[model samples]
Target: MPVPLIWLIAALALAGAEVLTGDLFLLMLSGGALAAAASSWLLALPVWVDGLVFLLVSVLLLVGVRPAIKRRMQSGKGLLDPAKALEGKSALVLDRVARHEGQVKLDGEIWTARPHVETDVYEAGDQVTVVHIDGATAVVAKIV
Candidate 1:
């Protein structure tokens, strides 16, 4: 096979592996292979020169480009943990919830609860919204 055709095949293989791994590292390598193919076919470069071009492109993309691209793709795309998902969810106070301690029924489970604010309080049977979780406690505010 021609040198360029070999490079193209390597690029395709790397790209396919990247899809299965879901990591950008192989994708960057595939980019380098594509560059090598271009150098071989378009520039008609020697094998050694094409190899050098591939190395430079791959290293540059892996170090400089991949991180920024990953960050952009991940922005606002974090998966919520189950506990964090409880924020803003409604709950029923099982005991008078004071700043220090109490109990509430949240997501069909009993959980330690507390008022969101120091002066805030919730009597038993009160409806509340979980503001956030602090350690093992759910900080909550009155529903209305």
Candidate 2:
């Protein structure tokens, strides 16, 4: 059996496992196997070189690509709770805002607002950054 054929079989098996796992990790390994097979067939590289290529490609995909892929896959989830998603948003103060009192337009809706710092005061039209959300109120700080 040709080495490339063996690599192709491994790639197929890994990809099949990926289908069951749905986590993309096995898919990355499948990609590495495919590359190894291609290198073996096209370059006619030595066995050690083909194995090295497979290992290097797999490591690269796992370390560099996997995290970004996971982030892209996870983005915009957990919408049922707004706390983690709403933090760090910018808002426009629509009313005088001080400790425990104010209103701001956040995400196209007005929300009760308060300064994150007790001494901070924000006037109408001030741009503020949402630091935290306490129940229905947004804690804001003036944008530097």
What is the clash count for each candidate, in the order shown? 0, 0
TM-score (all chains, Cα) for each model: 0.57, 0.53
Candidate 1, residue 60: the lDDT equals 97
Full-model lDDT, candidate 1: 0.94
Worst 10 residues of 1 by lDDT: 74-83
Candidate 2 — worst ten consecutive residues by lDDT sum?
A: 76-85
| Model 2 spans with C-alpha error above 4 angstroms | 78-144
Best by the TM-score measure: 1
Question: Mind giving the per-residue lDDT tens digits that candidate 1 earns over 16-116?
Answer: 99999987999999999999999999999799999999999999999999999999888875787877899999999999999788999999999999898
Candidate 2: tens digits of C-alpha lDDT, residues 62-131: 9999899999988855545677578999999999999878999999999999999999999999999999
Residue 122 lDDT, candidate 2, scale 0-100: 98
Error of 2 at 139 (Å): 32
Clashing pairs in 2: none
TM-score of candidate 2 against the unseen true structure: 0.53
What local lDDT does model 1 show for residue 8?
Answer: 98
